[model samples]
Target: MPAMDTVVPPEGTILTERRGTLLLIGINRPAKRNGFTPRMYKELAEAYTLLDDDPDLRAGVLHAHGPHFTAGLDLPAMAPLMQRGEKAIPPGSVEPTDLGTPGYRRRGKPLVCAVQGITFTLGIELMLAADCVVAADDCRFSQLEVKRGIMATGGATLRMAERAGLGSALLYLLTGDEFGSAEALRLNFVQKVVPAGEQLAEAIRIAERIAAQAPLAVVATRLNALKAVEEGPLRAMGEFLAVQQRLSSSEDAAEGVRSFVEKRAARFTGR
Candidate 1:
């Protein structure tokens, strides 16, 4: 495993680190169980933008510095922002939550999340938006917006029903009850569950494996999958065929074929 050198953020809300082609983004407010103040939301949005804009970064692992992934929104601090209809991402930053305005956009690259301890409200939504999730066996998740006297506005209402069946999603959303990692996996909310303290390592391993593949191919695969979910399967298939045609002529595609024939590891340049 490559050691990560934490890069201090100016806002003191998030920590960033580079691991070869993988970017590590951590929620830094351990004392608050990594809760998102308005400032932390902006910092996290910037980090997501950075991951997308840098071609050198192929994947990202979003975890936290403390025992918990996040306590979700800091209601008192965020209430004012919500009233003003302000989103977590600023004007130019990428929206990781995918809950911004109509023009909001997310990075094209893959994101893997590692969750432990308490993960509530927006924390659950974040995992829904990510490509893959690795949760600690000790992790407890809740979409507690109803309990807080607010509906889940952080993409949970929209995504949870799709990821977890409508009946299952409503069961938890309506009650605002906590669920265990096993339930999360069964609901298809998270892909893997590991022992406590091992979630980050497992997440990083998945990210590294993704980064090792051809970057363009990875992006195309992700886009196709997302498109299928967003647009109906019929429309997504059309887009998928178009993308396949374009990638077939790329330099990386040629290298992929040659390497297969030569029986050696393929080197992709994302061209």
Candidate 2:
């Protein structure tokens, strides 16, 4: 495993390894209900970059080691930073980029999260970037920045609208109201809802399935799907074909073909 950044306070978070295929990121601030300090986001950004570059890791699972996933940003940590200027964040801070992009972008593999209790503002934004999410049935979801005297800047207006459609997305964005996990599932914001304690295990089962698939193919498919929604379909299709041409020439492609002909599971080497 790579050396994770030291920015993360040892008390607030923990990263546990699972078979070298699944990564478990746990928010440990139960006293704060896992509310994030600026340092935590900086640590998260660095951790994400580390995971992005790891060849052996096939999937990541974000879960909290507490009753709540996150209570949103730490107000005390954010207030001083905001007082400086919108863009005047301290070095290594992961406050939302004023430039309208998410703080860190993961290119390959999938991110699956298990959310429970409350997830507000930036929590919801992080979930938007995830490929799949499993929430406890009692999870409370919200976009509370508007009521907090600021607009949601963590890609909520753009990505949330795309995930939940204009009307449903607007309902939460406009009113800053709380919705249950059922509503999140109905709006297609989350993939599944399990009983409270089952979320992490369920997410791991899903991530393991994702890990078993052909890695390069998974990357190509996700890239195309994200592009189709954000960029034009033509551009997405063009990129898809370009990726296909390269992947088709890979060793994993050969293994898949051979495995199919042999009538067995493909032992994809992710070549």
Candidate 3:
């Protein structure tokens, strides 16, 4: 991480900003196509930890500061960190990929991603781990790790089959063939596609819509959905009734009912 006291953009690092209820995380190595150096990866995990722990933050947006979302890992500097594997993360840091590596926990909030240009390898995996994505029409994607003689250790191998189906994911993962934004949408890898330069705006718009809802309800919905996806539907179903009962007894639930009766928007305080 760069000196927290310094304002200049470092050679490679992540940038974070609090945008109302949304925490915006930007990949800031534009000079290197926003690739992740070891420090950047660590910083990103810390940023995710901030989003997870901060009560005032309702959601997060991950995007790059340049034309490309990311060119994957910065091989030269990243090689050393890759050797350390999960040990690369410091204690108390959130694993940005949400792989549930023992010490880290997934943020109990929604994350929306925006991408354009060279969205390859780790970039695609990052999106696969996120809730939804907005892609610029010019975006290109691929799981290029195989071409480099390595395979994706990121969540791609884990979540791709779940998100895009086994065959579709295998075709690209095995061959490392690049696909465009349209193909990404067809594979259900991206939720929305817009003209170049509109990705961030659309992503933030969606995140703001999420933030506008009842905070408690929003977190509950995300938690239940992730539980269903990560832990299997049976386990999620087993807890569904209890979860709903808890939410139904909250002050926000009463506000939801009163707002419905009065035909006004509900005011949620996350209580």
> What TM-score, over all chains together, does every model reach?
0.95, 0.88, 0.94
lDDT of 1 by residue, 53-152 (tens): 9989999999987788898988887899888987766686788785545766667899999999999998998888899999999999999988888889
Best by TM-score: 1
Rank by TM-score, highest first.
Answer: 1, 3, 2
Highest lDDT against the true fold, candidate: 1
Model 3 has a clash total of 0
Give candidate 2's whole-model lDDT: 0.76
| Stretches of model 2 off by over 4 angstroms after superposition | 1-11, 85-106
In order, candidate lDDTs are 0.87, 0.76, 0.85
Regarding TM-score, does 1 or 3 come out ahead?
1
Ordered by lDDT, highest first, the candidates read 1, 3, 2
Query: At residue 114, what lDDT does model 1 achieve?
Result: 93
lDDT of 1: 0.87
Candidate 3's residue-wise lDDT over 95-194, tens digit each?
7787877767766788999999999988998888888899999998989898888879888987878878999989998999999999999989999999
Off by over 4 Å in 3: 1-10
Give one clash count per candidate, in the order shown: 0, 0, 0
Q: Which ten residues in a row have the lowest lDDT in candidate 2?
A: 92-101
Q: Which pairs clash (backbone N, Cα, C closer than 3 Å) in model 3?
A: none
